[model samples]
Target: MSGLDQRRVLVTGASGTFGRQLCAAFTAAGARVVGVDRQPGSIDGVPVLGCDLTDPATVPPVVAAAVDRLGGLDLLVNNAGVGGPAPAELPPDEVVRQQLEVNLLAAWRTTAAALPALEAARGRVVFVASRMALLPLPLAAAYGVSKRALVAYADALRHEVGTHVGVSVVYPSMVASPIHDSTADAGLSLEGVSRPEPVQGVVAAILRAATARRAPRDVATTRRGRLELAFARHAPTLADRLVRRTVATRIAAGDLDAAPLAAGMLRRHRDATG
Candidate 1:
């Protein structure tokens, strides 16, 4: 699991800002990558296959095709996800279901489909969860729930795979991505959104997790990210409170609609203290 030279990798949601960056990074690291997304597009000279992840019938075949094209997969990056800002009028249940479909169910189906290949390669599975998974937010009930379920799924899969195949779940905080755009479309402000780390940062982490000799069940790449994980593990109530306060502050400032506001605040705070 050290070198990625010629190893085959599958990255879901390749068209995404993170996904595309991840595919490029993996390719640069010498892995033969197959990018999967709902849109057909190429990344770093890698093939991008279109597949509707939410549709059970469509996901398996796409994975199968990716396996055939790459010969076999040594790593799987489940990065495709959605944060539906259900209109203020939508029922809570409907909102929750949409998030579950894209975030949890899709990840499950892809992992299940790729099991044999992952087992044969003794490779790794990387689940891209979020800080919300560790610390829930008020309006993001569905997104938080789906991420929590994903975390559980990753944990269970790690046990099921044992030492034969590695599994790692990453919890990234407020990454700059199209997720904000989606949220805004649903009527939420983009303020207090954390600037996304370079897509390469996440890609590097995924590569490290995949190639590591000993993979852990979870990895948080940032200080804040790690702290959030600790809070979730030891004092979930505390973590919840912190998140609630942060969101509340944003709402009160009327900056919630500002794209990249979260990132701006984080950067400003860091700069001031540093």
Candidate 2:
């Protein structure tokens, strides 16, 4: 009943928390769904192909196969992503590199591979970005940078293929998922800064974007997410001040004290305050 009846959809990161729910929703909406992930398997009766999206060599062929199986591609959901703690003060490391490779480049590669079929079918592409893309928080530089870069990629891609393909980006505030495990293990959990929203909200937003009369340029999964994105877009300076205040308060409360990656930032904040 979502205008997706019999539509052919391909999703990346099919094994993830969001991916599973998204694929299930699409299938229930009467769409034909196929997914690709590092681990190939079936989820909720949808067949998933195995592909290491980061490996440029693997994406094209796997996507081609999925398109073939689906008979034609109506939608491509770039839902794959990784997250971890990486302070901006430190030089870029593996965490940053991996995030960029998966969150930004992999999506780019998958989109490029799916473009031909998508264009043929006049299909849509939905990138599952994060609220961090707009309102970046401290100690998670990798996630913010990569997600912001993903948005940029979506923008440029739209301009080039807008005539033939639809492009949209969905921003989810924060969902309880293994994606945040690394950050939490490092003691940089976003408990106070971000209220976790239900994953179903994100799935619904993406579906709406995909089925809309015109592809929405951007979609936010929650009301607070919309407000945060508006602040970052319309009044960036104030947004920065608000984020800094939150960081300062967290430091004062020793919330980030156990996070080795946040140590440098914490020291600087304490020294300046003292």
Separately for all candidates shown, the number of backbone clashes (residues 3 or more apart, or on different chains) is: 10, 0
Checking candidate 2 for backbone clashes, the offending pairs are: none
Candidate 1, number of clashes = 10
User: Over the stretch 140-189, how does candidate 2's per-residue lDDT look in tens digits?
Assistant: 99999999999999999999999999999999988999999999999999
User: Candidate 1 on 1-274: residue-level lDDT in tens?
Assistant: 7888999999998888788788878888898999999987787699999999999999899999999999998989999988856422236766678789989999999999999999998888899998778676555667888999999999898888866788898877776677767677645644564434555566666776787778767877676667768988899788767766676577556555453424544455447657
- Candidate 1 achieves a global lDDT of 0.79
After superposition on all CA atoms, how large is the RMSD of candidate 1? Answer: 6.5
- After superposition, the stretches of candidate 1 with alpha carbons farther than 4 Å from their true spots are 86-90, 93-95, 193-196, 254-274
CA-lDDT, candidates in order? 0.79, 0.93
Q: Best candidate per TM-score, number?
A: 2
